[model samples]
Target: MKKQFFCAAAAALAMISAAPAQAQPQTQDDPYQWLENIEGEKALDWVRAQNARSQEALEADPRFAPMYEEALSVLTSKARLALGSIHNGYVYNFWQDDEHVRGVWRRASVESYRAGAPEWETLVDVDALAEEEDRNWVWGGVDCLSPDYTHCMVELSDGGSDAAFWREFDSSDKAFVEGGFYIPEGKSSVAWLGPDTLLVGADTGEGSLTTSGYPRTVRRLARDAALDEAPVLYEGEETDVAVAAAVEQDNGGAHVFVVRSPSFFESEYYYARSEDDALGDLEKLPLPMNADFEGVLGGRAIFLLREEWTYDGETYESGAVIAYGLAGAEAQTVMTPAANQSVEDVEIGKSGLVISYLEDVSGKAARFTPRKKGGWKRKEIGLPDNGVIEIISAGGGTDDAMLSFESLTRPEALYYAPARGKLKKIAETPAFYDATGVVVEQRFATSADGTKVPYFIMGLDSVLKQGNAPTVQYGYGGFLIPILPVYYEDPARPQHGALAGLMWVKRGGVLVLSNIRGGGEYGPKWHQAALKENRQRAFDDFIAISEDLIETGVTSPEKLGAIGRSNGGLLMGAMLTQRPDLYAAIDCGVPLFDMKRYNKLLAGASWMGEYGDPDIPEEWAYISKYSPYQNLKAGEPYPKVLFYTSTKDDRVHPGHARKAAAKMDGLGYDFFYYENIEGGHGGTANQDQLAYRTALEYAYFARMLMPRSE
Candidate 1:
């Protein structure tokens, strides 16, 4: 799996505690409240029963086995490109396959990696480590020291949970350092201050964490000192979400900084006075509370604004990139997007900054150089049009960087761009499935409020022309996360839509990706438009897209299906209760069903900034309008939805899905439910498990939406 944020572990801590006082009133009224006891005996029994029923029904289908095999082949194919980040003089990657179930940390020289035939040298084999330690060890990631990049800290999770243990490792010897810096299992953040020192934020003892269960104190620890003996560097309020410390290194210089997140969307930043300055006496950086500190580039601190800011009598709009000198507070605008564009990401190079932005939801990138006189200059990087471009690796003590590009019909291709040269293709992934006759088109649907929502449709021209083809529309319209088009190869990423093409579109089904409101497609304003009371706008936008598809003759009510997970799973729930007559099947994965009690669940309290607090009567008044569990009415023509969640999902509680299914059962509605014993919020632990779960989803859609000939 990719590196998950330490805040995930902090969120998981809520699972062990009782629900907040705000939920006490509803607890008595809920008959299924006992199901919230995640690992209780009775709860496991109920989960097992539902899992068996779901597996027996879906796996028994004639199409399940073949689809599973096809998915497995694509997942474990050796022809897939092994992408990695450039560090020191080598490219580092963590790889897993059928043979190595747990994966391995390996490295190769930049020349060899760029040559397309990397000669990999294994640093740590997780499967072997798991066997030796007698634990189900899952690879988290490694944070290496800059410059030489010899000493590092490796993270390991148990059973794919968010909580993990950290240990010091020696890259030169390819082994765990004996009697070196180590942090016991917890949701912790650690960064190297020096070879023998680290800035840490972890569970020190009682009262060390915030109300949201994240570390509220940052400490400076010496290599030879015990964790409890470490000196406190900085401390935040108990109401804060989290406090983290980091050391940013680049060609310009190295700087130490601390961040205090009071909520999911707001933060306060502090910087050390000098390299050798005391951490406890840091100076605060004067910047907007709703801005993200990107990094230090060329002696300037880069920031991406989430809200409009007025600094030095100059206004910087939201979604703009601005920079200030590390030694001074004067800010200058680096880049700003057009009305239809949003800056997606920013990365520091050796001497310049590389930015990835979206124009009308299409990906574009450029390099910004600081002019000798004053302002900055921009040079557009040439890339394939109508596709998503991502910065794979950058700012690893070099001016050269690597990027990847892909689209619905186009396979992924990696490119290497040097400081002074053009982009050269270094590697390309072979198409997993044939797309000779595939047609990709962008369309717009007028939403309930007359807003134009853009979406992508992929299918065979002949099949779409015939009309009424089995189709599945997917969306996630929250957290400012923009859904883009790409051919997915990594099971760990999960955001790619290529798997749909192989498993559904190649089999004569249509695929639709919705770019609705509450996304970063057009910038922060797009997301703010759907916050709190206006959250229904996102649901309305999705429903409008589905209706437009039917009206265009791409699919009918009986031939249409919908899929979403996590926040998107909440979208699935809204669709189920509000527009049951429009969809034939619903795949709701790890969803939040009972909105009234969502804030009491794991990590749900942290998202009150996005979804209003139900405890407040004023907010609940609007939330109650579309709370799926509260709105499900009897005698309604609802589709048979398949609900899947993980028992180890420390983020979203499994009870959300379980109670939803149980209520449907009580209402005489039939639905499918599956709960994996492992896997965190992702719902799968490894490639095989991912393939099996994916196959089950496709099979369920086939049974519900595809026509049968007897």
Candidate 2:
């Protein structure tokens, strides 16, 4: 069995509460008509008292002392993010090539900054723009853009169906090529060979199945003398396993390099020039260890090899990134965060590396550039005094690009800068809601374990903190994604603002965000405190926070409510089963309930690296102990919870949520369930649909947590 070795007594006691009594309801004059009911007041009082009890537990628990230290780090180090480009200059400005917001392409230029030098700009947003007719059948769009940006290659569906067609986008003429080649879709992608010629790697039915599933073939495309020319670069070794193809150079004419990795431990690269077939040297990135190679990124192929043995006697943080350089070279460790710290996003350019990582130091974000020799140019991008800095995109020249910026009181803004200097504002989105009257404060509460948890107190602060205000709290405790303030303030636009629950807030409800563990709040160490077998620690911490809030007289569980999505949904599920007496209502959306089979589902397997593979006996033993679906017993009273999932969710199988509801219903549990039939991962497809979904959530929260008859 693996353990973190370092243990604090306070942390352990905070993991379970010995006292959890419902608090007395606090009365208020003119406490919004919507929250005038006894049910609302009771719920509010319940959570408030729970929160207080949790605080007392922390004071008495020495094992949980570490949690408070970590929470303080998170609160003090939240980075204030800024946006910029750092590669070539012309492409740094944000541009939209696709009409669909998600599909829109941004091209910003990056240029080097010298003393008294003129700034340079380059083409960045060279992307496929979808015409009205382009969105007809397939979920496809433009392929590659010509070197001079005069011609664009479009990948259309076969017969306007699921199959794809390859056509050229000639900007000079503003029309597609007269005729096009049929490029079958698989793990295939297109690379430009010339202004008019393309290198497309595709697989047909016999080669790669055109249907919506997995396993496909690989090939390269080129221009043919006749309109109907077959594209056959090379046939890959036949196997059921779908290997990912990596393209090294994006803009080049001398030679094109293609790297193929069947697994993280092994890889093969083939290089060719001008449609000529002379496969170059095959490079293998071998790690003398048992590791799972994810996929390829940048010009190098990536692998996450788990060291079977612990490093310095610690098994919690043991994965490393091995980057295999093309052209038969040694695999270099391009980047590595603190042990156990999860890497969020990595942007590598000619300059170095800008990695967006979960807490590694002080629980805030840090930027590091690889020194030309052997080490790294690391610095804390000091946005912490205001808020957390999230690096959206970086690359244009050697030291610049546009970055998306935001803070507690600021909406997202695009900051234009040349390098490690001053940032000038370029653009910002219009706020659909007014937050002029709302105030958001960052506060830390000591948990039962003495671990401090950071939470955002948002609402009308003029009201006393001890008032019986209706409150809605949100939290997510899975994966390492952080919850930073969105600088979201809009009172008028209830649907778009934090006031999504404003129906309750407008009715005097306070909205709160708990930065629970199992998140990258205070770096990797903070998250490791509540992982796998220790997963219950996250739940304990959350319950403790709720207890503290109630004890502080913010709102009791009766008028208090909880909401979470995805893993947060799983958090809610756990809360409902483990401590249903503490919460009045819970909104669990797209959650994984069946812990026994979570790994068998779509996208669930990938999470095994994070959540641990339940199939494994050692890991399963711990997972089973807290598995929500298995732990739900018959005849136990549960909270009024609403479970939501999407039928079209291609990721975590909707079955987890669907079956949980069915089982709960059959077992006679009281809950609400709604499953959308469209929209893949998200329960809803578009913005309009999102508004409706949010409206329903607010309505449900208002009805249960802010009843109108106290």
Candidate 3:
């Protein structure tokens, strides 16, 4: 259910937990600042040399080849469900495999897709385009005109970077329109206002982007007109995160929205009556700054509250879903979470809202339809309970959805559910590894502050009874993301227990997914519990889980390993420096280590709403205590960590890993380091690259935690 009207703050905040980094000024205290030079030969030389060394060491292991093959096989398996969404009477899908490593944009009729056998028509072959143009192009996404959906804007990223080039595409003809609407790359956003017009937010020139490196100004670009000369609809402050535009064209007309995000969580929304409206024609919507724009439904704009707000003299509590009429009516309540409930994924379908939520750390889903009489009519979509549920594909002009259900040990089942219709099991992935003896269970660990932190532990029942087993705990406790016990995650680039099952668990290692504070497992309150100064609570929660594992005789400190990326990578750093004795190895991938300078690097400034600004002395007082780089001590019993990042990770600075590794090297600590030359924040561009990295990770874990014979 990805629409132009996603939570602006959450989208920006994702860069912290879901992306990578680079770019910063050199300081006297930072000796490894040269690594921040994204394309500098000197920096690249160091990265290349380190990659060679780490790859040799990890790939030399006997288990590496088989693991790589298995990962590749699973990633490229055709039996895997083709997750797609209905668009213009068809279901569109972006596919990648061993053949189409760069991926292909394909679509099939809705009937064929629902029948579980889509005769895909290739719209754009990225692998062919990359070869023909001699460019490292990655498929970004496409924004199309509503209804017809023939005219579209195709986004193409260079080597999987966030910044991308948008070109006019004609889906009807399946070709790029010559000299059609084009927006140059630079953390941009766009939507079709009409057949000949687009509402765009992009880096036009100097001062066009916010301090966070996102477009602060949005303009209306006419077909065949110069992007620079387009009419500026609105301008936000330089300090603001960014400004974005979305168009909702329906029976009424084209309703334009410009969301001006001043911070990660605060925003001001402006609206236009029609696509022809000018800058002055835009009217500001009276809404709370902390309120998030979900999407428009039945002439009303949907919102989710992150804080209590008395709107129109009525109070709406945090975590409440509300809707406001476009004709300027009082805000009405949509859905209020129950005592044990918190919403997770929200997708706006053509006629309904598909909400996948959590109840006491478990998954549930329902479709909310706007009733003519008033209030939202909720219809629960029945699926397997007590497992991870993901809305694979929804919206895109259809009430039908692609849903996935899986537990830690169970293979994922893909279902096609129609609006108020029965759930049809269209596809299911075969078990990657034998899970005959494997079992998954929910457990709670008491944190330092006496909060019950939920976590999922999966392994062989016999192994649990044996009392001690090598274990890997994976966590990402920030950005409202709940780490569910799915056998895998993201069909586009699947990883998790799915690969770990084949590579680690099957080889006698345990897997754990921690739902600590700073995540959405228990909703907003759970996340707020670990904000800024309280960030250590997340680390404490993770530490408590490790202690519980050892106390319960599950595994020992010498057999434990912690793995996380991005913000979770920061968590790993905290674990490495703060509680090194608890784990045998730490996989800190594309992590933010230099907390003091994080805001000054890449897109880190946008995340100030999450981790407070380090320049603020008061904030530094709380941050410095756990800031990994500044806190790194020479004699600390830090684990031999495996630090990895991408050379072009434009979200979190690669220098974070490079600097920390260099500092550790200076301290005479022996550790492994690797950097992918082509991957971006995700650290891998294609299935093969993903397979290679997956194999490397499992091999490292195998060597560090598994038994010698394995």
Candidate 4:
């Protein structure tokens, strides 16, 4: 595995060196210098200045007005809102941007009757959440709600190389659930045993390894609430095991431990109760499964694995019936939607479970019931395909389940689906997002390889097709992360000018979402078609989609633009380097540009299973061929490119974006760079901070791609 990793990196490096040299331009200060020298206040100050300037330019653009008005209308409309389930009765939702708090995190009543009714009350003032605690702890990676939903865990760092716990939130009162422990600077991952049972694992001190490096012990939160009394539940060789999943099973008493080896292709599990007298005896379970596993669903282990046969080339889950009492072994084949279709969330209830499978046959969600004869009985739930479904559990008491649905043009509609019945309106998500002038539809385009690619297009119905009309195309074809409909009515969408698209669509502009390979638009097959050496297929598919727009007279290359973040950034990067002639503007944010050094960098090492090892001689030949950073050339008429990242982005190192920008500058490519000092993977940690960055991106797109009416 290690050898394969470095081989991929080597391949990437070879690709970089293989490129012909460009005529070096006049030397400028090394952009990477700030990365090494800049400290706290100074780094943040730089981010603020750049944002201020970008905002000023965007707000000043004359074309920004109408888009802003439309954006504001959709953002504040009452017809767009929903009550989504996050933890039992405590829901999760993003209210209107025009709210007094910018955006409120509120909890709502699951049985509220009228849609758009004021049933939710604020939980945490986001502004206060950011100010009172460090952003990294509160806004990093993903957060999990406790089984009881009484407390929330936050991962934090103290400026050392690694991360540690900074704070905890009391979910009941929506306040800080404080036990105060200044974990060593490098310590990370604070898992809760129960509501008050805390388990911290990591190295300690500024850089010193914790005893034997890595988090070797799972410490228990003591009865006295003191750090010293926190005894080690499991440590040493046992800690090396990767806990793929842990659930409160055995009647919400015993915790089942499905531990796994580090390999992406295997799974070895064992379960034990917290109160078990022999807690150390973790007996292995007899199950034919792979390392690629999903979390437990309906008290059953749900996961996808492939056969050893090379012909398999697919990821198939064992489904929700995997671990059920007598029904588990029978096995049910739950639908794995197209690679681009998201996995519909599974809601567990006592009456029966509602498993919403995404992108099955169509983009819409499908429902399933565990059958007496092995597999599940499937039924299509006719919800809009353009939007996503968020299932709200009624805590197993009520027969009715609430749904939060939204799309780009439709806003958000909160509905209640009572046990195998029709959907009734409850409330909109935004409670103020206007849908009076909205339209959305799914479109298909033929790829360069004759493959039919799917896409979701959104715009105002009043707009007419014009050749010169601006268009913004979006895509992300990696990790099977579906690009579901975004109900954000921001005026700063690409087609309109950062804020130009929202307003431009009202006049005439289009938003096209390319359902290319590397995404689950069709399912595992769609993604596998573009895996490893075939990565370029996704880019080719995207290019073909863009050409389709031009052929149909919807928009031309001169007025066309593109946007993608992270893996999608990688796509746009390849597009800019491989087909710069096809786009007028591009927004590449937090991208993995330097494929060669990606593994060595933060979190990049883990994704080798997706993108072949750069170190591998064979894989390098193909990977380097399309690697955006290494493939860049000089004296070429490259499209205007904007590269964005965050200094605190501990995942895909900011260096990826920084180094790419530096290379672009040295090669004299028409490019711009912006770096945020906070917000881990995301450019910002706070919603308002995110809004500011979003506005900046839209503004840049508007400035470069939005055609001037004058």
Please give each candidate's TM-score.
0.96, 0.65, 0.95, 0.78
Per-candidate RMSD vs. true structure?
2.6, 14.2, 2.8, 7.3
lDDT of 3 at 326: 86
Cα-based lDDT for every prediction:
0.83, 0.50, 0.81, 0.55
Model 4 lDDT per residue over 272-313, tens place: 546632354555554443323344444455444332212124
Q: After superposition, how far is residue 431 of candidate 4 from its true place, in Å?
A: 8.9
Which candidate leads the pack in lDDT?
Answer: 1
lDDT sort, best first: 1, 3, 4, 2
Please identify which of the two predictions, 1 or 4, would achieve the higher TM-score against the true structure. 1
For model 2, the run of ten residues with the poorest summed lDDT: 9-18
Rate residue 217 of model 3 by lDDT: 85
Ranking by TM-score: 1, 3, 4, 2
Candidate no. 3 TM-score: 0.95
The parts of candidate 1 lying over 4 Å away from their true place are: 1-26, 277-280, 489-495
Give the better candidate number (1 or 2) by TM-score.
Answer: 1
The superposed Cα distance between candidate 3 and the true structure at residue 189, in angstroms, equals 1.2
Clashing pairs in 3: 20-651, 20-652, 21-651, 21-652, 21-653, 22-653, 487-498
TM-score of candidate 1 relative to the true fold: 0.96
Candidate 1 CA-lDDT value: 0.83
As a TM-score, model 2 comes out at 0.65
Task: Put down candidate 1 lDDT per residue, 1-710, tens digits, no spaces.
Answer: 01122122223222213333214443666787777777879988999999999899999888889889878877877777788888888989888878877899999999998888889999999999999999988877788888778999998878776667889999999999999989887777788887888988888888787776668888889989999789888899998777888788756345888888787778888987435534436878888888888888877889989899988899999989999787778899999888899998898887898899999888898999899998999998898899988888887888788888888888889988888887889998898888888898999999999999999999988899998999999888887877788786446333355677788888889989899998888999998889889999999999999999999999999999999888888899999999999999999998888899887776677677788889999999999998898998799989999999988776777889988998899899999999988887778777888889989999999889884461
Q: How accurate locally is residue 500 in candidate 1, as Cα lDDT from 0 to 100?
A: 74
